[model samples]
Target: MSNSKLYKGSLTTIILKLLNEHDKMYGYEITQKVKELTKGELKITEGALYPALHKLEAEGLLDVEVAKVDNRLRKYYKLTETGTKETVNKLEELAEYIKTMQALVNPKLA
Candidate 1:
């Protein structure tokens, strides 16, 4: 989560947004993609990532598929129908949050 506590709250939203962009992704791939996207500024730990993924799966927002690759079973996650819709809603909410924070942090000069 880098050096900021801010990323913790948005972890689930981040996962959903990534899943929304790609068809499906495994755990490691997701982590690498995040690091790549953030240019190593943000790092998602396994401890944090797995729980969020489980929670999303439990909530019926995500579906998982297990496949054997190189004698190891890997779980791939993809958004459910509800998840796809939720992604859009979550993104909108995040956008609004950013806008509010920007207003507070960089208020217009009067």
Candidate 2:
């Protein structure tokens, strides 16, 4: 969902999952990639994105690399060893959560 509140809890998991798939990415790139994948249905705003990145970095699940691109510094993030492990755990948790939601949302099929 593009609505930030709806996806707030899972932002870290989404970020980690993306990093797991793509090696490394900067903030804007992550937002763009998410939007592209979701076909513009989901947009990660600056206000929501930076704090989450900082939090993940604080948690030791992410590593940051800064590079000078043109005249600006672009910071890229990748999963740490624990982060890689965490990606698998978080993904499993997310999958289970989605399954539960699906079942709840469609009890007849469940």
Candidate 3:
């Protein structure tokens, strides 16, 4: 699948889960973390990532903190209380989705 297609439905959950694990993260950090976690199977681009981050912040699921890091202002994202709860639900949902897809793709083996 195209990287965009691969991440299509799961980007938000990935972001939320990463933030939940790390407590806080910046854009590049998020991108790199996904790459590391997926062993480069998934790549999050700045184009896809910034818009989603902005939307999540607008939706109140994330809180942004600005700090000067290495002489540049970086925006860090952390889960709000609502985001934490939402992450749990999203993870459960994603787990079910993976199971369903696996069954479809490998029913005989399963």
Model 2 pairs in collision: none
Over 1-66, each residue of candidate 2 has an lDDT whose tens digit, in order, gives: 636687888899989999999999999999999999999888888898999999989999999999
Ordered by lDDT, highest first, the candidates read 1, 2, 3
* Highest-scoring model, TM-score: 1
For model 1, the superposed segments whose C-alpha errors exceed 4 Å read none
Give lDDT tens digits, candidate 3, residues 1-110: 26478568899999999999999999999999988887887888789899999999999999999999897899899999999999999999999998988899999855
Clashing pairs in 3: none
- CA shift of 61, model 1, Å: 0.3
TM-score: model 1 vs. ground truth: 0.94
Best lDDT among the predictions, by candidate number: 1
Q: Candidate 3: which stretches are off by over 4 Å?
A: 1-3
lDDT, candidate 2, equals 0.92
What lDDT tens digits, residue by residue, belong to model 1 across residues 19-81? 999989999999999999999899998899999999999999999999999999999999999
| Backbone N/Cα/C clashes per model | 0, 0, 0
- Each model's RMSD to truth, in Å? 1.7, 1.3, 1.5
Global lDDT of each candidate? 0.93, 0.92, 0.91
